[model samples]
Target: MASPLKVVILGGGTSGWMCAAALSAILKPGTPSSILDLRLIESADIGTVGVGEATLPHIKEFNDFLGINEAEFMRKTKATFKLGIEFRDWGQVGNSYIHPFGTFGQTLAGVEFQHYWTRAQALGEAASIEDYSYAIQAARGQKFDFPSEDKESIKSTFSYAYHFDAGLYAAFLRDFAEARGLKRTEGKVETVALKPDSGDIASLTLASGEVIEGDLFIDCSGFRGLLIEDHLHAGWEDWSRWLPCDRALAVPSERTDDFPSYTRSTALSAGWQWRIPLQHRTGNGYVYSSAFISDDDAQKALLANLDGAALMDPKPLRFKAGRRKKSWYKNCLTIGLSSGFLEPLESTSIYLVQIAVQTLIALFPSSKPGEPIDDKLADEFNRLIDIEYERVRDFLILHYHANTRTDSALWDYVRHMNVPDSLTHKIEQFKRRGYVKKYRDGLFSPPSWLAVFIGQGVVPHGYDRMADTMDDATVIEKLADMRVRIRANVDAMPDHADFVRDYCFVPPAKVMAEVSK
Candidate 1:
């Protein structure tokens, strides 16, 4: 029998623990046929960048794959449901719209609903596109409920994500992974040793002089990229000229009575601010460019704009906007911030980590004696990782480039600066006919693109010719009907706070205890 492939994950935050849990669950040891020996090394002195409070609906799939109980996870983590993200001023000041998690209106005559809505607008109908989305309506009404299984029903049109404490989540997964037989090392890594012949990592030496050997290394060491960059010299691909926000001021504030069902990103003078409400408290942050705004001013801005009393002094985090040149090189794969960082404008940090872990598992290699590392697998893995980063980069750029805010140099610069040809092409295509660029795999879907395009005032000059085939009266009537049905469905759903209280409410004493600790 071939020997087991020893997988050593370096760093312990959400990424490392997630990888550990999944690997331990899928490849349990104790049998000769079992193929993986998993261990995660995390240091007590190192702090994780845990400001990722919001998430996309895909997190549910990740949790389900690991066999975690949804309610229990939510209760333990102090999580709140997220229907979608509400943008306050990206298009222009005082203009608000939500990028929902589900589709807008059902297709008409095999054509997308946005095209029909565009045609209706040209015919003197003036309802906002937001009127036809079930998710937007639910979000606006502060309602929450699981989607129905009936595909034809409006109640089934929307999906949900979560707002939780990232630190608690990592701890929860630590317990989970350890229970499944994954070993944990508590010391900090001091140095890495490489093979002279292949330059692949051979072992990691800890500060205590204990050397741990492994066949494969996974780097989740945040921006430093200890193994991937410091050791292997994987170059960085900087996108700062496009996404110049280099600093963030994150702080938690007291929770309020109004627990909305969505995250909120409001445009600021030099950058933007985020409002993420968890069950225990509200997570707030100002992601801004230091070149344009001083750190002192940014801190003051964040403190002034909070929803409630500040729970703690604002904490600062710094980062550039880009991914590593190669996510997978030789035997080491970079996940999370080590691989890349696109701002959490759309809550994609966790999703990126999830995708990398899933991709790695799919292309897992054997490390039998004298077996060479497969170049083909590494190449394919890098290709897939590139697609994920570039696609997400373009989507985040759209949020800034498509904006109509011109109050500050920051907004004006992003609005007029030249974007990637891929993004420019997508903008032009949407401008002409409201057509969204499709992809085989990536984050944002058509509904997501349409929401930003229309919400940010990127009105198209024309609609799909097929949309013209529908009579003007029928199109208007159908849209009006959709609006009515969406409103009714949202009205029937329970209040967001009430639903949370019933489903996964954390006890006040437990929450306070965690806070005190």
Candidate 2:
């Protein structure tokens, strides 16, 4: 039998355990056997920025890949269902829209329902596009239900993610990985050493002077990129000009009885505030550009707007909105914050970690022990990482640029800023008609783009020429009918809180206290 490959992962946050769990699943497929010897080094002194509470629907697939039981995982993490994100006051004061994890109404005559909706709007016969989405209606109604498997069912249109305690989630996955033979070493990494010839990471020396070596190094260290950047000299790509919100003040507050099914991002003066409700408490944060708003003022704004009494003092996190020039450098692969950062506007922080780990697994090295590392495989990994980061970067930029808010300098600057030509072409194409550029693979589908564009008041001049075939009366009638069906389906679903209780409730002390009232 071949000797096991030694895999060393630095840092132990959500990213570390996610990598450990997923890698364990991959190596021990079908039965419990190890192809890789995995060990994670995490420090008690180092802290993780635990504000990533909300997630996209892709997280469900990651959990399923690890063979996790959804109900058990939710209970352990204090999670709540997230059907979509609701943007409040982004277009104008009091304006609101939901970017759902689902499609708009089903195709009308083989054309996307949005084109028909656009035609009806031009004829002054349509309602807000929000009325035609099942996820949006259910979210607005504070309802919850697992998506139906039946393709023809309206309830099957949407997918769901989760809002959970990031810290608890890490611990949950720690138990999972540890049970599957993942070793955990607790100590601070004093220094990282590199090979003289290859320049790849050779070993990490602990504060206690213990040297640990590995064939492969996974950097999960936050922001610092301890191995991938600090040791290998992989460059950081600054994206502050495009995504300028460089600081965040995160805090937790008491959970309220009304647990909405969607995360909310309310536009503030200089930036935006996010409200993510889990079962135990609500996670709140104000992400702002320090160039525009003072840190003290940002903290004040965040505290003032929370849904309930603050549970802890607000903790500040500073980060640039960009990624590493090369996420995979030589034999070291950077995962999580060590790799790079794009702000958590769309809850892509955890999703990005999942993608990196999954990508590495797909492009796992084929070289035998004691052979040279494959440069071609590492380059391919970096390429995939670049595509994911850039695609997400553009989507986030659209949120900042497609705004109508003129109340602050931040808004004015972003609204008029010179966006990338890629984004420029997309917006122009959408404005000419109701169209969205389709991707073979990436985040943010057509419905996602449509939600943002139409929600921010970007009205197209024309519909798809194909949509013109439908008469105005017919289009209006069908849209209205779709709205009726969406509302009825949403109305039939259970309350979000009640569903959590009946399905996978974990009665934490705080949650129980809130429920008693």
TM-score on alpha carbons, each prediction:
0.98, 0.97
Q: Which 10-residue window in model 2 sums to the lowest lDDT?
A: 26-35
Clashing pairs in 2: none
Quantify all predictions' global Cα lDDT against the true fold: 0.91, 0.89
User: What is the per-residue lDDT of model 2 for residues 8-73, given as tens digits with 9 covering 90 to 100?
Assistant: 999999999999988877785223345688889999889998889999999999999998999999
lDDT by residue (126-235, candidate 1, tens digit) is 49899888999999999999999998788899899999999989999999988888889999999999999999999999999999998889999999999999999989
- RMSD score of candidate 1 (Å): 1.1
Off by over 4 Å in 2: 29-33, 510-517
Using TM-score as the measure, which candidate wins?
A: 1
RMSD of each: 1.1, 2.4
Question: What ranges in model 1 sit over 4 Å off?
Answer: 30-32, 515-517
Cα error, residue 415 of model 2, in Å, equals 0.6
With candidate 1 superimposed using the best TM-score fit, by how many Å does residue 245's alpha carbon deviate from the native?
0.2
Clashing pairs in 1: none
